[model samples]
Target: MGYSRGIGIVGLGVISRAYLETLVGHADVRIVAVADLDAERARAVAETVPGARALSVSELLADPEVDTVLNLTIPAAHAEIAHGAISHGKNVYGEKPLTAVLDDARAVMASAAAAWVHVGCAPDTVLGTGVQTARAAIDAGHIGRPIAATAAFFSAGHESWHPNPHFYYLPGGGPLFDMGPYYLSALVHMLGPIVTVQGAGSRTRSVRTIGSGPREGETLDVEVATHVTGVLTHASGALSTVTFSFDAHASEAKPIEVHGEAGSLSVPDPNYFDGDVRISRGDGWELVPVSAGYEHGSRGVGLLDFAVGDAPARRASGELALHTLEVMTLLLESAETGERRRVSTAPERPEPVPLTTEAEWRRIADA
Candidate 1:
C-alpha cells in the first residue's frame, strides 16, 4: 500500500513558502511537522501551521504520523534529505533537478525501490493546464506527429534576485540545472524520452554580483557554464534544440515550440502552472483553449497526485525527475566532451491530466 497523506517538510528556504501555502489547508493530507537546518526558520513556519510542529530533521523523518517528506532543500542536499526520508519509511516529494549529482540520484532511486516508498519531484507545472492542454493537443494529433521543437530558457542570472545565489554558479547550478527541469520535463512529456544529446556551453563571466535580498553587491565565483545549447533526439525520432542561458540578457523566442507535419505549437512557460498555449497553422499562432489538466493549479500540485490520487501512474514520479536530471547532466557531459552522449534513463511520459476546473482540482492539488 502507498504511504499515508501525512507530510513532513525538510528545508525551509525561499521555495518552502509556496509548498507551505499550497499544502497547509488541504483536506486529504496533514502537515505533521517541518524541519530545517535553521531551527528558527522551521519554528517560525511551524507556528503558522496549526498542529504542525518544528522538529529536528531526524525527528521529523522518524515521526510515525508523517508518511511523506516534502524536501525543499538545496540541490546538494536533495539526495541526503530524500534518503533520510525513505530510511524512515516515508515517501518523498522534492523540488527540481532531483539531485546535484547523477550518481547520488541513482542511489536514491535504488533506495526507494528497496524500501518500497514512492518518490515524487517538482516542475509539476507541466501537469497544469497550459502544458497539459498543449500535450493533449499533440496527443490528439493537433500537431500531427511532432517532428521537432525548440525550448529556450534565458535569464540574466539569478544572483541579483535570489538571496543566496552562490549555488547558481557551482558545478551543478547553472541555467540548465536551475531552469532546465521545467523545459526538459515538458519536452519529455510532449516529445517522449530523449535518447541522444549533443551540446556546447560557454560562460560570460567568472564572477557574478548579487542583485537582491540581504546580500546585494556580493560577488561569487562562477564554476559552471552560464550558457548551454543542445540538441536532443527523442525516442520517437523528434529532435529538439535547446538553449538555456544565464548570460543572455533576453530573448524573443517563445518558451517552447513544437513543429509537426501538420502544424506547430507554442507552449507556455513550463515553470508556471497556467498560461496561453498557442497553435499555428498557415494563418498564425492561435490560442489553444484549456483543454486538459488541473485548472488554476499552483506549486505542489504534482505532490497532490502522489499523495491521494489513484491513476495509472504518478505523473510527477521521481523516475521522470531522474530522467530529466540525467538528460541535463548528459547535456553538460556532451558539451564538455564535444561528443554526442546517450542518456541512460528512459522514463515514461506521464499520463495526461484530465480537464478539471479550479473549483475542483484546487481542493486536492494541495493534497
Candidate 2:
C-alpha cells in the first residue's frame, strides 16, 4: 500500500508493541525501520513488519526514507534519541514525560525549534473521547465555570506483574512521573495550563519485591516517593487536588472529577481511549454523551495525528509535553522544599478534538 509518511521506531521495549499494533499495517504511515539496543529483538520485530528493516539506532536515524522517528526509549534515553533524530532532520513522537528531567525537556523543545522539526509526546489519551468529551462539555459551558477538580490514580506498584519493573522505582518512574502524565495531561486539556503547584509525598518502603517476571523474589531499591499528593493551580484559577500512589493496594476513586458552578463532571480513566463522562447538577448525575475525539483510538493515534495535522492543530505537540513535564517536576520540587513551585512555562491550550468516528479518522489517515 502507498503511504504518506515513514516511521522509524527506536526501542522495541514493552510499549513498542502497542505502537507496532497501531502503526504496522496502517494506511497513512509505513514502518520503515526498527532499532533497539538488542539487535536480535529489533531484527525479530522488523521481520514481522512488511518492508521494514532492522538497523542500529544511528542507522535508523540517518535512513533517507525515515520521515519521523517513533522514540520508545526509556526516560533517561529520551533526550538522547530525540536530539539524535532532530540532528538528523526528522520529526519525532515519543512516549510520555518528554524527558527524565525538566531541563532536558526544555532543551529538546529548543533543539527541535532551532531544527524546525516537529516533536510530539504521548499521553495522547487526552485526544481520545473520554477526556475530549469532558473537555467539550466544559468548552460548551455545560458545567458553567470550572472551579476545582480531583485526580486520583492508585496502585500497588508495577512490580506485581511487569516483567521488568525496576524502572518504576527510579527517579522518573514514580507514580507521579510514570502515571501523572495521563491525569495531568487530561487536566490541562480540560482546564487549561497550570501556573503553580504545591505538593507533598511519602515513601512506604525503601525496597520492593518483584512479584512476577524472571526477577521474581528479587528486591529493587526505591529512589523516589511512592505516594504523591498535590494541588495544581491552573492559569484559569481552577485548583485540582491530585493523589497518585504506587503504595496503595487499590482505591475506588474516579480517575478524575471536575467540579464547577453548574455541576460536577466525572471523567474516565485518561489512560484509556474512551469512557462515559458523567455530569452532576442539582438534579443529580447524568451521563454526558461522547461529543468529541477519535473513536476507537490507540497508542499511535497521536503520532498519526501529528503526521496528518497542521502544526497548530497538533494536540500532542512538544510544547504541551514540556509544560506538562515542568508541572510534574516542579511538583516534585515543591514536595521536597515544602514551598509552592511556580510553573515557568505556559503553553497555549491545544485546539480541541472534534467528534470523529473510527471510520472517519481511518479515512483521514488513508488520505
TM-score of each: 0.97, 0.97
Which lDDT tens digits does candidate 1 get at residues 1-367?
2343789999998888888777787766779899988999889999999889999999999999999899988898999999999998889999988999999999999999999988999989999898999999999998799999999988899986789988888866999999999999999988899999999999889989998888998899999999999999999999999999998787899999999999999999999989999988878888898999888888888888888787455899899999989999999988899999998898877888999787675564332
RMSD of each: 2.0, 1.7
Q: In order, what lDDT does every prediction score?
A: 0.89, 0.91
Backbone clashes under 3 angstroms, per model: 2, 0
So what's the TM-score on candidate 1? 0.97
**Number of the top candidate by lDDT?**
2
Q: Residue 155 deviation, candidate 1, in Å?
A: 1.1
Q: How many clashing residue pairs, candidate 2? A: 0
Q: List the residue pairs that clash in candidate 1.
A: 160-211, 160-212
